[model samples]
Structure formats: structure tokens, C-alpha cells
Target: MKEIYLIRICGKCKKTNILINEEVEDTIKKGYYISCSHCGSKRIFKENETSDLRKCMDNNVYKRVKGKIRQVHSI
Candidate 1:
């Protein structure tokens, strides 16, 4: 399986901000803050504020599993 990453979308620039799982955890424990790299907007260091990279990429209409490719549709 491919490694998944955490991401936060910038509200102002609509840019994706990637985050390390370990770093996020540590930051939450220490009450540190995070910001958007593109627009310099402050971000909350909460799990609910971020999303999994896989979930973000689910908008793709196609997917590949093993050696085969298939179509995907969103409701």
C-alpha cells in the first residue's frame, strides 16, 4: 500500500498544505501553531482541520489497483 499523508487546504489561496503525521501529533501535544506556506494564513493544529491525502485525491475519475485500472464515480 502507498503511504498516505495529511493535508490542509488553504482557505485564501486554495492551495494544498502537506503535513507529516508525526509532526502534527507533536505539535498538538505542545500546543504549537501551523500556517499556510502559500498565503501565510494561520491554521489550527487539530485533526479535524486536516484531511487525508487519499480522501483529497478521490476526486479523480479513475483509479488503478494492482495491475488493473478502473473507473470511479463520486456521489
Candidate 2:
């Protein structure tokens, strides 16, 4: 059976990282690399990567799409 992985889009890079489990899902952490959608820069999220990501939906930090493919978001 194909496992469905929950992914969180990186606000900085817009790169989607498959959420391993509830750890990353419940609370948002920083230090992970997310690819930028513009310059293709592998950027790191601050402490509020989770919250920041949610804000990105409106603030335009990042956008979510229906696929697993990685979309690079640049500054």
C-alpha cells in the first residue's frame, strides 16, 4: 500500500518536506532546508517555520500545490 505522507511547505523555499510523524506536524521547528521557488536557494526556516508557513499562504511567503514534486521558491 502506498503510504500517504503529510508534507509542510517551506515558507522560505516553498519546498515540501514529507512530514515524518506527529512531531513535526504538531509543533513547527526550524533548521531544515527548503528550496527557494525563485533562485532555487536552499534556505532554512526560523523557529516558527510551521506558523510562518501558514502565514505564507496569505503573506505570500509560499504557496501550496497538489503534487509531491518540489517547487523552488527564491527570494
Candidate 3:
């Protein structure tokens, strides 16, 4: 099976991270990512025994779509 991932979305500007993290359901729902991609809100994502490395979209684009895939990373 393909690896699933989770993401964080900004509440203010609706900015989201381009880099998807291999996170769990609760973790993503609780809100991940250390900060916002656009407005740069200081979000404190609790840490565990996971790596802290991530990649982000430079233009801060919002990927809009409406579809369903067989493998999905719930958030």
C-alpha cells in the first residue's frame, strides 16, 4: 500500500502545507505543522518520537480539488 500522510491548514488565510507529513488521524485532526504557510501563525504541534523535517510550497498555493482516492490520509 502507498504511504499515507496528513497536513495542516491555516485558519486565517486558509494556507496549507505542500509537504505532507506521515502522521496519524488524531495528530492531524488536532492540527500539525509548527507554523502557518501564509499568515505564519505560531501553531504548537505536540512532538513525539518523530522527525521534525518537512517541505513546503514556496508560493503558498492552496491546492483545491474534489475527488476521492483509494488510499487517503485522513485529517
Per-residue lDDT over 1-75 for candidate 2, one digit per residue giving the tens place of the 0 to 100 score: 432344445565455454434454445455454443455555534322332334333333344467543334434
Alpha carbon lDDT at 67, candidate 3: 57
As a whole number from 0 to 100, the lDDT of residue 51 in candidate 2 is: 29
Clashes of each: 0, 10, 0
Range of the 10 consecutive residues with the lowest summed lDDT in candidate 3: 46-55
Runs of candidate 3 exceeding 4 Å displacement? 1-4, 22-33, 43-75
Say which candidate scores most in lDDT: 1
Q: Scored by Cα lDDT, where does model 2 land?
A: 0.43
lDDT of 1 by residue, 1-75 (tens): 433466566666555566776676678699977778767988433322334545655544557888775535433
In terms of TM-score, the best-performing candidate is 1
lDDT of 1: 0.59
TM-score of candidate 2 versus the correct structure, residues matched by position: 0.26
